[model samples]
Target: MLKLGWFSTGRDQAARDLLKVVWQRIKEGFISAQISYVFLSREPGESKESDLFLKLCQELGLKIYTLSAKNFEPGLRQNNREAWRAAYHQKVYEMIKHEPVDLIVLAGYMWVVSAELCQKLPMINLHPALPGGPQGTWQEVIWQLLQEEANETGVMMHLVTPELDQGPAVTFCRFPIKGGEFDPLWQNFKEKMRQIGLEKIKEQEGEKEPLFALIRKEGVKRELPLIVYTIKAFAEKEISLINHKLFDNKGNLLLEPYDLTERIEKHLKTGEW
Candidate 1:
């Protein structure tokens, strides 16, 4: 069986949704892999989501392991940056070195994986935006897209590299955001916020959004298919990483770039992919 290790922060629904897709695919025979271990950045006591994930892994009969960022505290972080980083890297290296892992997958891991860790194994990450789009945290990516009046956006599973989200693409799936159609959802969310009191919204401006609610709706719709497709490709040995670039079975770049307005127009026209 294919052996895999999962790295995540367990802070968001996206990561949970992704894990659900993986589990579903495994059940359906799309992926014949076993999760060997899980490495979390959060302290064991701090994450309820982490607890839930651990329970799921137990049900699946997978071995679970954890490393806490708190262990590498002030000495490595504030007192001396490089020394701290080096010590932290050694800890991660030791974990992977001793574990039986074939691939490393990052699911909403908040901290950047050190370069030393990246060089030790094949790694992949799921980012909120398509490759080559705006560079920021996932929330920032969504906010920027909305602010720019973008009609389309997407998610990508890409090879992880040292430079943030600048890794080569693997599989990308796009969806449309019809500005006019989403107005009702936006208005509804706004009114709900108003009823809840504007002060609550004021304190949570970045977190409150009609657009995000809509995007999340779309994510639930698309996430399964995308994860299945990507994992299937990987399981079949149909994807490769050469010089940090992703290539299809034929050695050509897998360029599944997304077009925003065009996708919206097509959906408006046919209501289908």
Candidate 2:
């Protein structure tokens, strides 16, 4: 069985929901693995959400370990945030040094991991874009896709490196954002933005643009499913990282995102977890 290390900040409902869904799948025998430990960046009382998340982990009987990023952020010499972050990651390293974790999954960890730590662990992260697509937060990705008039977007699980979101993808699912259901909305958004400029539209409407909203809805629906599928792939040995490069069980290098459209569509249609 794969010994998994779970890393999350547990900052929102989505983070909590992800843990629930993944744990449910594990309990249902869908994932051939056990979570060895859950490493949280925040301690109890940092926020109600994180506290509740910790509570849920305790209820599930999973080993829960925590290091408060808030408590560590202060007391950095020279006010060097990067230096402080690296030290904090070092502390995290000490906390889990003895655990036998095969892979680490960053579910909702908000901090940028240090390069040294990235080298020490095989980690994967959820990014709300396809392989070789826009880079940044999901909101930035959506906005960039719209500005570029992209026809497709996707969700991917990629290796975590010093770079924020540039690592090679392990698995992904793509969907079209143009034509069909999106044609009218895209057309209107383009025309409106051309008339009023993107800055003005953003100031006035924020993320409520029809096209943006629809695309986000489409992508959001696939996020958890993709994460689950990615974990399943890892647990089943369908995907592996050999020398920091992704490969299949046959040792074939994966040059493109593993297209999971059909499986995800089935799950979405069947309401399967």
Cα-based TM-score, every candidate: 0.78, 0.93
Off by over 4 Å in 1: 12-14, 79-86, 183-204, 242-245, 252-273
- Candidate 1 residue 46 Cα shift, in angstroms, is 2.8
lDDT of each: 0.67, 0.88
lDDT of 1 at 75: 61
Tens-digit lDDT track for model 1 on 1-273? 566788877676666666766766677776877667777666566677776766666776666666776667666588876567667767877866788666678877877777767766778877777667767776677666755666677777778877778877677767766667776765665575658754465367655566766775675555545655666566676775555566777878767632233443354467443
Candidate 1, 56: how far from true, in Å?
Answer: 2.0
- Report the C-alpha lDDT of model 2 over 18-54, residue by residue, as the tens digit: 8888888998999988888899999989999999999
lDDT of 1: 0.67
Candidate 2 local accuracy as lDDT? 0.88
